[model samples]
Target: MEFFEKLKALSYRARLTIVLHTVFTLAETIGGVFFNLYLWRLTSSLALIAQYQFFFWLAMMLGFILIGYAFKNKGMSQLFRIGFWLNFIFFCLIVWLGERSINWTVYLGLLSGLAAGFYWSAHEVMVLSGTSDKTREMFYGVLMSGESVARIAGPALSAGLIWLGAKWRGEALFGYYLLFAFVALLFLVTELAINRVKDVSFERFSLRGVFGLYQRKAWRWNLWRSFVDGLMISRWFVWGVLSYLILTSEVWLGTMMSLVGVLAIISNILIGQWFKPNLRARLNSWGAALLVIAGIAYPLLLNPLGLVFDQILGEIIGIPLFTFAWLAWFYLAVETDYDGKKRQFEYYAGHEIWQGIGRILSIGLFWLLASNLEQVNLARWWFGGLSLLFIVQWWLLKKVRTALVKAGYKEE
Candidate 1:
């Protein structure tokens, strides 16, 4: 009750952004869980999924660079709407592709990545402009909570729809098509809503200048943090593990994902209300440590029981803590002065590039390793590797706190 009231006290722009993100999250969750399943059903190759994601990250990196330039020259809303429409097209293309050929999955990944880069870049800018430093954490918490709620509903609904389609048309693909269509409609609505937001413009920045920020100690750490963050959150780790579980057991995909969502919702509420600014470092450290533990435990529990235990721990503890830390640090990075509004795009662009590089490395590595190993051995080795990677983030969080302190911020 108190938390909702606090969220309500935020500025109108912040509230609007929350609403927009909630819609976007709902649309994403509906088809996102099933996308890999669709590909897996069509082609039972992990390599194919890896290649698809590889290209997706590659395209996203390029899109971030290009779209950042566009945001500087044009208005933010234009790029955002373009992203929305592109995503709608991406889904439409998938519907058209429909098991006819698995080869097109690569192209779809590229298209989805491009759409993501534009949409997320614009969305972050909106979040930056909409909330002040005082209200940023509150806004982020509310946005996350809203996303958790959407996630809970979306996966469960998607599962039911898939079941219905299987019963009615005798093909689960039909349900995927329906879900994709709904996602398209949601994007259209989102596009229309963007028109209501105030328009803001920025002066153009040189690509050279943006890339050159890596020389500074703070910027370098920020970039590295983006990479580490990217590695932690990549699909290869989260979805890859989950997909393996579905393949091995009779676990209901929608129900399991929805259960995770339910836990995530509870964590979001606790974090939003109690995770104060001063406690950022402490909470982040704890989160990082827990993630490391989960990583270690996952490979040890390579069987069904281990997988279930890892999944439960990750949802209830690992995700919320790490997410809170990352969001807090990111908000600080964006809010830190880099000259003026003119250069904000460059900062974000640089951040995206670093993040993309990290994702590419993580996914590309997985593709390489998994390609060589027997499918039976892939999950175990992958989980081990992923657990070790969490240590990098733990180290990076400390560096971020140090950097923030040096920048005259009170506390991380």
Candidate 2:
């Protein structure tokens, strides 16, 4: 029975794709953190770093939209291929400009944003097709675990490379470029490997048929519920991530990010292994509630701590930092069984839109209100208010969960 079961599992397309995807994720994860660190180092301005984040998020939003239409039109594979190579080229460009100057760093940020735009959209769509919702959430957890591992491994490796470069008369940014090159190499290799996998026919990959599920009233309500859950939470996460960048230094940023990554990985593992699929929806609701609290507290927290200590805590808490935990939760929520294709897209779109809104509002708030407040005042009052918001967020999540039950959702 064990032999037969192993054989059966080996025949699954998703399992194969997950393996290939993991390889791609590991490289990108390392390359991406190093890239961000280098960019922050060059500019040392939180606003500029936030601008880079804005562009990256904006690109993903637009890319997902286009990928949706493209999937509907049967051009999914072509666009994804474009994404793979575009990422390759983008990393290569970063490698070519490893002098660590301000202008080059700005250029790197733009290119990285462009690359992320391509990579995230295509990668997400591809992953969606590769697994059903039954396994997709678990699959996502696995993939994230790979990334979290990379988070720890990438920085450690980059730190080593930086040391080597220092000894060899090479610039520190060269270490970043080296990591980029290695990651780009992984993308190309994976692209080649994916070509060998059996191609998914557009007919079997149905946008219309899948979307028809959304026509059901139950699914529609569930989707809307999921969307609200995402919107309420993501606003604070993005705001906090950028705000922290303003205060954190490049040298320690990767280590801090890695700690957050570790927390996310742990979360993903717990969800995939212990949480039942039905219960996962409620868990997402709870997670979003936590995010709202974290969101409100993070800025206040950043305000009070000097950049150094803030950096220390950011690593320890891992919630509102520059890690992927927020998006991971948002995706898990949207991909719940109660949601249909329409809701999935809506959830994705809503998450991005809310993040964008949060970024804009937070920036304004900081500049208008918090910027003038002394660190002590900001810490005491701002964090206090944030803590209250978290409590509110928790209440809101419970209310949403109850509403889901009232709407006849057996799981959520």
Candidate 3:
């Protein structure tokens, strides 16, 4: 009853944004579930997968940099619309190219990445603007729940549709192209919904001012943390790929993803309700440590089922606990720099540069290692190595937290 009351109190802008997010997110998930699989079917090259992903993050980082300048004159709504249309165009190209898309992986990846980078960057700002402190919690809760449900439902339905369609249409590629068209066409709904949102103005900071944000000590430290965060959240490191390879079945892949999605939803619910400031250090530490454990343990199994177990620990337990706790730390540490207002968007832009670099490096490193190392050892070495950075982040948080407290900063 209380949650419903809060939900009812949301502004129209918030409502429309929620609708846009739900539809866009659903289409993205449906299209994404099989996109790589389609590529894999065409070429079966991990190196190509890594190359496609490398360019995606490369363009995404560039998109962030360019959008920062664009925001000087353009509204977030306009940028979002551009991203929305670019994504629509991306899917349209995939449908049109069909088998030929395999040759254009790098270009397609760049287009999609730019679309994602701009859309997410602008959309996040819109979310912050659309709701006040009183209603923000409920707004995010509803948005997250919708996203979670889409993750659960989209792949399940798409997998079934493709399997059935293979028999009816007599070609697997036809099912994929059909799904791409559906996703591309679905954007019309989001386009209408987002246009309904009135543009709200934020204080514009000069590009010089935005770039100068890096001079501050607190934010400088946060960039390092966010870089590791990006490495952890790499551009093309979807776990289901390994699962699909091992299981050799789309249905199995969807089932594993849905089960993991259910567990993630449950974990997020529990974490959101139970998280506390005093417990931040402990939870984040546990989460980081668990990720390392999962990474190291996963490759040992060498079975398709290992993917499910790895996701259970990594996504459900490790990711949520660490992510929530680290986010709490960011609010306390990073967002508190020098009045923290008049430059919120600038802070976001500066952070994106390093984070995007980190993502690009992640795939770049994988490609290099794939050249020399055993493919089987990739997860162990990659996850183990990256998890070390989490520990570094954990220490940085402690140092920054104490220093901020001494400097008279407090979590809002």
- Residue 260 of model 3, lDDT score: 70
Ranking by lDDT: 1, 3, 2
lDDT, residue 38, candidate 2? 62
**In candidate 1, what are the lDDT values of residues 63-95, reduced to their tens digit?**
978876555657777877888899889888887
Flag regions of model 3 displaced more than 4 Å.
1-19, 130-142, 205-207, 233-238, 331-335, 371-380
Candidate 3 structure, TM-score to reference: 0.88
Residue-wise C-alpha lDDT for candidate 3, range 1-412, written one tens digit per residue: 6556666788877787777677777777776658877876787655667777888878887787677666754577777688888989999999999899989989999999899887777765666567653344355556655666777877776677677668788977777777778778777556655663477544654568666866766666777777866786532354545666677887777776777767666666556455555666688789888877776566666476566667888777887767665555454443455555446667676677778777777888787877676654674456556656767777766665665667676444
- Candidate 2 collision pairs: 293-390
Worst 10 residues of 2 by lDDT: 316-325
Two-way TM-score contest, 2 vs 3, winner = 3
Best-matching candidate per TM-score: 1
For candidate 1, report its TM-score. Answer: 0.92
Give candidate 3's error at residue 251 in angstroms: 1.6
